[model samples]
Target chain A: MRWEGRAWVFGDNVDTDQIIPGRYLRRVSYDELGRYAMTGADPEFPEKVREGDILVAGRNFGCGSSREQAVMALQQAGIACVVAESFARIFYRNALNRGLPTVEAREDPTEIVEDGERVVVDLDELVLRSESGEVPLREPPEFARRAWREGGLLELARRNPERPPWR
Target chain B: MATVVERFLSEKCGERVEAGDVAVVEPDVIMLHDGSGATALRTLRELGTERVKRPDRVVLIFDHSVPPSSVEAANRQNELLAFARRHGIERVHVDEGVCHQILVERGYARPGRVIFGGDSHTPTAGGVAALGFGFGGTDMAFTLLYGELWLRVPRTIRVHVTGDLGPGVTAKDLALTIVGELGAGYADYAVLEYTGLPERLPVGDRMCLCNLATEAGAKSAYVPPAEGPERLRPGDADETVELDASEVEPVVSVPDAVDRVRPVGDVQGEEITRVFVGSCTNGRYRDIRAFTEALDALGGPDPNVRIVVVPASRRVLLRLARDGTLERLIELGASVAPPGCGPCLGEHLGVLGDDDVCVSTANRNFPGRMGSVEADIYLASPLTAAVAAARGELADPREELPRTALERVSGS
Candidate 1:
């Protein structure tokens, strides 16, 4: 799916805590999760995040704690996709399983997108657009993309077992 | 040639993994955590590597956010299970217990051996007297595909603990104390060897020390094998070794100490908010007992503090019930999360609120570690953590718990 919204850029190692804190975990529902999205990093995130909003971050984007709650919090908050220089492996999988797409590319999003600047993300074409310019970004692995489209890897494997060739 | 881990670290920037001048390559067991299993399997499939190499030597765990707080999370864990089945890895332990916790109880982790895992906390296994280190998904994949993994023999730093720990103090505190002093990246690529006190420290304390070695950025950590009153003993000692554990004093330095320890308070602290107890590191019976003893001493938890305790394994949970420790914890107002990861990761039961402060016994207090980046995390010993939980503030419990509990636990 393609989405576009203002961008929120973060620095490297923006851990799961900054995305969603543990104290809020007592309430597990996604509805409550969105309220805590980036709440630690940005308290006003819930009210400010618009549908289709994209989060761009630096390296180690989801380091610390392997809680999938961070992914849920972001997706439930209406975050369309995350573009980071790198992603903690667990968080990367957690994102794909929940149908939240993440990409790893070397370019700095801070240079191209500001806190409130409009941006567009295209998963199919693997490109990001903002007022500053359009940039080519790395795409999620093929299986990951297929997984996202089919609701997750398991469903994708169930429907098209031979699709990725790896399976 | 640089080892798979070293090469990958070199290629991946930002994380900045550098190979040391001397590479130590010895691993008795290879542990894989969560999505890393799937990744390793896929890498094997792609590489068409043969034999899957000693499936018995591998241990797989699902501790990292895969216990399924939601349908999606559950599905992901299912995929991991399927992947392991396909790979023919017999040592798979999924959603059963924390990896380090189970390894020690199951006796899969032995001291003086090399150990590796895809999860960073693999170093925690060293508590059982193994050389524990963590690698990435690709490295895990490479290792499983080929029985041998390359390495950069790291300069060994030996920390000698000679003095008796005060009451309520534990290896968890020792680890936190070291990490707090060393800061997160002090030992970036070093191998830490903890020695001294075979009779003084319990097995749980050793695990806590080795577990937090990663916090100091050490590549891997170990405590020299010593003959305990148990079945385990330090293996053959090499004569060429430069450092002698016996000669060192009871001191810790980010450098001078075998494993540099950076104090949590010095690294940075913001405010007081929530406290968590559990995870593979400090989630054993001993860990829980420490917390309970502290809580009992304090009478109960403070009104404002939100304390959550998760037993490491079902066995542990049952044991606590049988011993009435569970009732006391519940009565004391400590919320007992299901025997899994609980709040260790933000996936289940309890998540942290925005801008909250969390003190936990689990390793890695990184952003969102307890659930929010805006929230600050402080790593501390179980005693510190227990006392903090009881008073609803961060306080070391060395001065709190009775001396009887401090008596070195036999058989560790």
Candidate 2:
């Protein structure tokens, strides 16, 4: 998938509280969640966001709460993809399992791309390009990439349980 | 090395274990929340499982969406009743309390064992020395199908706390502080073993430590069986064939602090928009007393803050009520919620508004963690929370606790 979007920059350890906030969990509907995405960290986030916007963040993105709602909120917000330095394990798996494209931004994408700067994400090449330069977003470790390509290991196993290649 | 808990689950349950693999344990108890119980019951019927291998191992708790907030929820409760009766898995905790609070107060989770539930914070069982984690509904259904489940043995990270917390820091503060430094997913598939703080903390605080293990991106967190002059429990070995404790120092790839940190900034924020004083983390009688004492010291909390006190169990609630603690809190503006999840899951009552900011003693302050997708939740100790509730913002409680209160909290 090839896509381009402007980046929404966030700093280190951006926790789940900032992403979805715990209070709206009871709402349950995806639309309600989308409206409040990142309200804690940036109150105007929902209104300011546009479709195909990429979330650019530092380490531990999506850290806290395994609730799938956090992912749904971002997806519903029309987040094209999330590129972070690293991710919480469960959140990373949940993101990929739900079919949201996520990549680790290698070499500070911060210097090359700014908030609202026109940028392109090339999933095939795992590269990001802007006015400054082309930067490679770290590809998921082999196993995770395989899992991502195969629609998550659990789904893969369910579809072809007998030929479990990982086994 | 595999922990004894891991070795036990691995040897007993034939699953190739990895630290992060979520396991479905045949819950010695199955607690359901509101309409969720109905979902569990319906799934059970569809699976057509005959005779639960251990009927005694299940518990149905109806704490979420309780008092039947809606007709649909009430209908779900009836279905739960029918299922409980059909399966003979009695010990159903109804609208009386929250599931995690009730389980601990009622002794369903004892030291040194394992427990699983449909909710993720099942790690709250760590308060009583049990391995707890959340499971998928299908996984829970499968547990009913077969009494066993699979797991990945996780490597353990030992976090040693030395010296005493500088002041105002609670177990919640320590846990949050650690998670803050560790960057959430730093130790993705590890068991965080908190050690070397026996002289500085009580069993309650230790429980709080382990209960929030999930927040740090670890599968679970633990404390080596407490040893000391108070002798809360008896003699324990530092080593076992399954795992050895004494040999390890408190270590994590992420650093917690050069030392304990104070609040984020000098200003104590503003009047708390909300106050949450219960969870598997610190919802026990001890936590209750700590909170009340801090509240009393502040001459009760500010009028603006909405304090919600949820007991982990009916027993804890009963104890609080009998001791007049519940009455005191209520008089001071604390709303005593039923014995189950209140603000923890943002499920039932006590949800935060987008404009609200909370000071809570529960684990994790992740976005959308409390209930509102827009509210901000801050993690602090029970004392800190109590003081914050009274002071109308975050303030270290160590300065306010009477020497006697401090002594009792320290379990000295």
Candidate 3:
């Protein structure tokens, strides 16, 4: 599958609070939630973000909290994909379970793709092509990619109504 | 041929499974709190379902914002009550401190069972040999509707702890030592399998280790069950680390990073403005009793230092109240907040002002964790926290305790 988006660059250790602070956790408003996405690290981030924009960052991205809302808030704001050098384990899993594509490239995407540079993400051939050059991407385990392909675990369950013990 | 985590996953999946396998398995317990319960339920409802698949397997906890801190919080709780009623989820606990504590007290967590909650510290249940981990609200919603979740089998990292702890060297200190020795990201995407004389460490102490595993980027922590519950040894470790508990000193996780730990002596006498002595990490009977006892011995804290004690659960509070321990803590100048996660996450309770420094018993000292991003949070044990509050500075508790009391651990 092919994906296209502009890169929204961030530095290392971009925590969940930075994605969306703890103060907004009690409520359930997508618009209200989207207004605060990335506000901690960049106050004008919410307004600057556009639909189908990809978030690019360094190591330990989304390094705090089990709150799935952080990923959901980004998804709501139309964050097409997140490519990081490394990700907090839970955040990586959370994004997948929510059907949001996340790629971990050995080569730091932040160095290859600059801010607002439109790049193409290829899941089929395992490559990220930008005007600068073509950077190879490591494909996640097949099961994880399958979940993403199916649009998340919830969608996967809808396909297999029998639940576990797939007899 | 399978490790403990793999075996547990296999059992839950109703078939033999291997490491590196990803499958959806319905866990025995699915816990949620006021902060995320409504979202989970709403997600399930939006999926075109009004009834939960198994209400008996779900628990709703109202500990994050108890006693109605605001109208919004109150409205959220009311909606949660209605949602819980519409469905058959009868296992609801209000003012029960934290969901992790309630998960154990309600007998929902035990050895060999897979437990999932919406909070990160849910892995605290692993201290009791249960396979507990955290998930997001959407996953919780899916689990609530179908009683299962899709999970990736995490690689196991065996942590073998040796030696007996010396004077005032508790499990909290050992955890800090391990976090410091091994970087916070050492256990990333891995499961921590703790072995070697684990029974010597009580449930509370073991929970402390598992609770802090998140800071080390661990997906989960497990202490295999000792009884009839089947035990599976970990597979060939991707990595191994050995720790000598006796060598551990009372340490602290300074502001801005959970892994950046140093001996308390290094940062001692730093004037403290506030102190908190509770959270799932160190808010059990063992911890609170230790702090209150330390206060009694030290003649309580200085009036200038702000101190708040939050019981981990309603059951813990009752246990202390029944034994006259609660009154003693109150009389000693501790402003006891209702049983819940008070002030740990920097909500309406005990928020720190700018430039303030707080010594706390909770996990993680990340920026803005307690309140202001500029304020510093020093993570320590309850005894150390009480001492800091009493002394109005970050002083080591070992210096004040009697030498006899500082003797070897009870089991050792």
DockQ of each: 0.12, 0.24, 0.40
Per residue, candidate 3 scores C-alpha lDDT tens digits across B302-412 of 878888899898778888999998999888878888889898877767988887899999887776767676788999987778778888888776887666545533222
| Candidate 3 stretches greater than 4 Å from native | A1-6, A111-135, A141-167, B225-238, B408-412
- Badly placed stretches (over 4 Å) of model 1 are A1-167, B1-27, B41-53, B198-200, B228-273, B396-412
Q: Candidate 2, residues B182-263: lDDT per residue as tens digits? A: 5456556666666665324665676676666676666665665654232222222222122222222111111111112345
Best by DockQ: 3
* Candidate 3 interface RMSD, angstroms, 1 decimal: 2.6
Ordered list by TM-score, greatest first: 3, 2, 1
True contacts kept of each: 0.17, 0.31, 0.31
lDDT of each: 0.63, 0.63, 0.79
Judged by lDDT against the true structure, how good is candidate 2? 0.63
Q: Give one digit per residue, the lDDT tens place, for model 3 in A38-103.
A: 866777888889999999888788887877778888988779889888889778767876788888
Worst 10 residues of 3 chain B by lDDT: B403-412
lDDT of 1 by residue, B27-132 (tens): 5688876545655554445445434566767888776553566554566568767766776877777666777777777777775456767776777766666666
Candidate 2 chain A, run of 10 with poorest lDDT: A157-166
The complex in candidate 3 yields a DockQ of 0.40
Q: Write model 1 residue lDDT over A1-167, tens digit each, in one string.
A: 67778789998667666787755643344357887799867778899998888898876577554456677788888888888767765577557655688877657665677887888887777777888777677866666777677665434433443332232
